[model samples]
Target: MTTGPGAGTTVELVKLTKAYGATVAVNAIDLRIAAGSYCCLLGPSGCGKTSTLRMIAGHEDVSTGDLLIGDRVVNDEPPAARGTAMMFQSYALFPHLDCVDNVAFSLKMKGVPVEERRRKAREMLDLVDMGKYAARLPAQLSGGQQQRVALARALITRPGVLLLDEPLSALDPFLRDRMREELKRLHRELGITFIHVTHSQTEAMALADLVVVMNQGRIEQAGPPRELFNRPHTAFVARFIGGHNVIRSADGLRAVRADRVQLGGGDLRTDGTVRALEYHGTSVHLSLDVAGADDFAVIVDEARFYDAPLAIGAPVQIGWNHADAHPLAS
Candidate 1:
């Protein structure tokens, strides 16, 4: 009923584990990344996102568990031998090689003839809309261009799994958005599995067909973007992904979403004073102080805000149906 990135078989992680002596880099976990799927390992820094990605790419040795590439175990294979191409966070483009040569580096290493490698690289560059910049060196290209070259280089190898480590973190907002669309298009065109790692919630929401939520070396939740947003499984996820106020209930035993409360209700339901209202073009965010409950905020339409505005001194009542509140039990 839902989908995110690519379409194919599946990439299964069977009890994957990675540890650095006493420090657990990745706890025992199981995951199945759908084939041709664009899955992002999303979490804060030090959560072992890169470690999990590296294990899949064979950059880091697995402590235990099986990694299956389309139903075949790949735990013992080398990165290249495992049929995966990794685009590192640093871009990792060769400084001396021009864009074309850099993009063709892998093919050339694989014994692809000069002419064939050059032609393929040029085709890839054109696919990335960087054909005109083929002759430019890494120093000559902008940051975004360099990143694209890194991507093209990875794709030139035609590997089964494409491992992207925070690929868009360096680009500005505009370029990041454009590149997100480009990545989606490339995934559609190539039909290869994409496993991306990113800490940015916006990027994960925009780019992932499936999101693998990680924290402190463990998976928190994994699901489609909409499902994760609309029905987060834990308090950490609710607060981390944004756009929702997790409020503690009156008895201090539960947290509820602020937007779930009906503003036109008989009382806005427990007495609270308006603290502040932050207005965006389309919506107004209300900061409230509810007695007997933790502080919270609610989002209302800008039109609604204007039609019935509440001042800072105004007392408000807010409550939602029990069924509308999701219990964060994870």
Candidate 2:
């Protein structure tokens, strides 16, 4: 991959840490994000995902360790000097300024001519599909439109890396999904590294090429979403990433995808009482209470499940193949 200015740059954190006196926000962590890759720092609040992203954006001080963008160490550099742009969860568009002006604010700070900056701003708005709203203020536009303007503002700088701190958390579910596609398309077109910090596992699974799962200020696991979902390294990862049922088997702790757990098939068998059944449009989620396991779940196809539906508290037999079980660390 190419390195340096204007190109997607490799981001490396060597034992990076952040602390507030005795309290450590981010434990010493090592991560190397490939150039032009979409990487997501995923974890619940207080897991230090935001702190790590802020440190990379040069918005926060690194308590210790090296912060490298491309081949250059950028620990002490200012935010603007780090070749990174940050988009906050709030979108932070200038309410008073029109969309075009909001996007051109960065260039205006650099003393660019009004006509030239506005022209550049319009181009950015066009890229984000917000050109038609360029003349409107933040209040006049919708939530998604405001977000697009914010994105255009961040991109106007043409940085090597884009650091987003929960960019879609503020949008409605439908808008969030639409914006996700927009973000992915933008990343492909721009070919720049995108380091997004989000707590939503669904978002990470949908968007990230690499997902870094953090817990208690440290990385629990880091890999492709499928690897983390299919083969979790630890119990925390299995539970945090969702969709899987972690259980203590005779052999050891293992995790099976809810979809993989069969209601009444395969050689391996176990008996459980139907604790709850949820009817989703495409699939049915069944919560079961096995003899030894806590709350086991199986995702059944909507049509198949309805064909022979079981009632709550109904005794049911469940089975899964040995190959479907993925062992987990305690």
Candidate 3:
């Protein structure tokens, strides 16, 4: 509970897989999460991200391959023995117990003395800024406060690797943003590896030092957030990451960031009819009906957009510099 760094163990998966009867929820996939780094498993629903996390946590059996934590292969280890802790989407705090008792429950099961467990619990609550709510039941706290309690509980055992499954999905937008800051701070202070699973591209970009994009139980790309954004390897990654538009050209398929596309005046030019426009505070998001591209879009600066605002259904020429277009794998 002290404010210094905690040593985090490295996690690696080699051909890890999970199957339920004939359905392979997680196909053979390999990944390495560095010690003390924040990694996010990103994809749409049923992409095997949750299954992958569960396998690492030892909650689900790996159908094949090895799971290594630091130097040991722990494919047969129990959840409590895996040196990992999972914070579920529901918060999952015990409704009948007060905050302190909820956090101390694991220690109690381990046969730690009552006073000692309570002391450690208080320290964890203090770590999460929930010390003042130690005596309150879970039902009495707000959604955000309950989340803090759950976080404290997960950290009470001093896990080397923390696994989160959509931990922010239940909160409101404001609280989600605030909690994102708190999670980042905790990762910095604790210096522990965090493997978080989420379908939100924005959330992954905001928190992950490494982003792993999954589709159909396979990794499409895994790299630093900026690398994946600036140079996505495939059309799926470009489309799923939200801001990039995939276009088919004479040479092959390519991707261009929406902000880099201009209404006119660039090396590559195309004509499209504006289909939709959305105001997003600092920029305008415009969807266009281009011939070969589905969901073709562009982002224009607020000041520039207002200067020559194009109404929906207006025909306009859109283009991007040749340097901005990144080729994608077929």
Candidate 4:
């Protein structure tokens, strides 16, 4: 692709806020995204992930503070001038246009010569492996194919930062996994910053080099996926990231990974009745009805679970090492 001005630019949000009358969507949040890195703004619905992304994309106005892209404060810039391209959740390709034309639409609007625009569009299509279907309309392509076209269209601008707002949410589980790899490959090949908004913890963990977990218009934690998983700063992050059971201990609330819990071994032990069991192929998730912790759970290997096979309603002892417990802020 063509590396235009602002390519591989670092994005810095200093005390950024987005407010709508009485409702504050994105509170004063400060964040720095490194150039050529993959960052995921992760949170549940209404957590302001999308709002933050739109503000960075210049689709929404920043209510307070500065939004700097490579040292230039772009708070007053238009969407096209922000050096960012957004691929919408719905893959908003024009239905009347074919894949190539859709990918070349932006250039067409800029009054580029027809032949040159088409040639550049074809290159982007080939980059996304959608060149073979260049003549196909949106109706003729599958969800994954349409998404690829949208991606090419977004990248055609040679944006420094590619903003994806739930780009893979429309695909099936299998297709999502495949496209996740595609996104990672594209980010590496292009060598530009990528900011993806997602609600799926697994998706963020799989794709992002930096994961920012937001909750109630504030960032709960921001770090590498492994760090967030292993040492979550708050109860919301510990629970939302999954696999962790938050328990009220003698000192304070603590978080423990489900995989660290042993059936009948460890330094700390507790008796609980198995309330539910979920078969995951490689492992089994056991939900227990402990006295103080209502949502206590454990993950056991498939082989070990099948060997003993504790049934629902069976009383069992679950324990973990004291060092495995991570303290939570609240």
Candidate 5:
């Protein structure tokens, strides 16, 4: 009953597994991406996030289990037959073709007339704010501009699900941030499902409504970004997400946010020596070497740290509220 690219199809993977001979890449993972939501599959290399995305896009055949789009099974469907479009990390725009023509290529393949497909392609270009450069070849545009053209090409299919494979990884920091915002805006406007794969936690945290963390071809945790960040259920989740310190307490292993750690005094206190100090423009991160734990960290306001700097090797007592601590599995 949904319309436009916003048809908002739900993608479900039930006991999905992808194997190559003796090796297993995706090991019986089950995931349900809700209709119209932005989901990010986050992990380091070889974690199977890319494999999972490719399988969803029909680029890779599922080794086992059911892959569903909406109510129907799409495991045997071709990439174009599935209501999904993938924008690769490389952009993959045609160098010889102009912007509009590149976007219109898919429509041309479908046997649409040149004039109609070009018009539709231009409409897509305008949606991504690249309409004015419709005649420019991929060589004439910047990296971000070419990415936009590629995005338009993908959206022209009016796909229910748009898969992005590290789409911003190739861009510089500034353009990456800019394109990240553009992607969020496009998702909002189109109301379609976006399954983005990235190794960068910052990108996932900034863009996703749901974050799926994977390790060694398994999902470590999957939840809202704030939930996973604030209440990581495992040490792996805490460590991999960053900004959290995994420490052992009397109750057992637990994770606490670095920013919640009070350096001076509170109900729960621990003593450690300052081993490293990193100053960001807004805050200072003090890495502490506790005797019984791995590197623990605390983030203090920049002004507070500069007012009374803690010298390296200085023994410091850090404390936090008991309520701020969350228990973690071994």
Candidate 6:
């Protein structure tokens, strides 16, 4: 009741464990990603997120585990054997080929005729809104455009499973935002399985039906972005997702959502001195010093702060309902 998104897909990982001699990259784990769902493997670098993704894509051999794509186990399948396509962090487009040719390269290998491949390639490009740029080479296109070409190329195969490894990490913030929208729209239009891997909490939050949190070759949690952000199970998630004040008390665990907490609402009722404030256009990040409490930083909307009592060096009361304080994995 405290944490979970309404279930969407049915992806299952049964006793999946990947190891390299003394090092275990992915521990024995079980997970389910529903079909036609957008799931993200979120974790810091070297936390087995990429390992987990490669295992699913058949790029990395599973040490000892079963991978299920929908209902079938594909543990021994090759990358080409599985109905999956991977869009790597590097665009990996052919520089000599135009956008359309790059998108249709896989189709050519599949033995489709040139006309059919070109047609399908153009269709996929149009889906990503890159049809007009089909005549341009990789050099003529921007980073984001090149990414779109990669996405189109991946989709041209009509892959039942799409594996994207930090596909948008190369783009600027503005382009990333736009591509997020494009990805969301494209997912609905295609209705295929999308498994994305990234460390950016913002990317995971903005685009995911299921968000799998991983650390140290293990899964920390898996659920929707809203559930993970609003009710993180551990301090790591709270800290990793940013704009959270994690505090431990005899009462229980507490984390103040920057967007949910009221700033200095009850003056002198709580024990916190405003140490610093950063104004970010429409919202403010408040750094509070609480005695007997760890630094409880919060994010509050500037518009809502009109009724808030926030002053530098002022003692203020900070409060949140007990219902919001939920248990998490230690």
Off by over 4 Å in 3: 1-4
lDDT of 4 by residue, 204-271 (tens): 99999999999989999999999999999999999999999999999899999999999999999999
In the predicted model 6, the residue pairs found to clash are: 9-34, 10-33, 10-34, 10-35, 11-32, 11-33, 11-34, 233-328, 258-299, 270-317
**lDDT per residue as tens, model 1, 33-108:** 8788889999999898999999998899999988888767989987777778899998999999999999999888
lDDT of 1: 0.83
Error of 2 at 271 (Å): 1.4
Model 2 agreement with the true structure over 188-211: per-residue lDDT tens digits: 888899999999999999999999
Off by over 4 Å in 2: 1-6
Tens-digit lDDT track for model 3 on 1-330? Answer: 112357887999999999999988888999999988999999999999999999999989999999998789999999888888889889889999999999999999999999999999999999999999999999999999999999999888788899999989999999999999999999999888899999999999999999999998989999999999999999999999989999999989999999999998689999999999999999999999999998898999999999998999999999999999999999
- Candidate 6 lDDT by residue in tens digits, 1-330: 011122223457898999999999999989988878999999999999999989988989999978987567889988776778889898889999999999989888879999999998998899888999999999999999999999989877667778999988899989889998998887787777789999998889889989999999998888998888888988888888877767776656666665555554522235678899888888788888986557777677778765654789987667665555556556
Give me the displacement of residue 59 in model 2, in angstroms: 1.2
TM-score of each: 0.92, 0.95, 0.97, 0.97, 0.96, 0.89
In candidate 1, how many Å is residue 41 off?
A: 1.1
Question: What is the C-alpha RMSD, rounded to one decimal, of candidate 2?
Answer: 2.0
Model 5 residue 181 distance off true place after TM-score fit, in angstroms: 0.6
TM-score winner, 2 or 3: 3
lDDT of 2 at 275: 91
Q: Pick the candidate with the highest lDDT.
A: 4
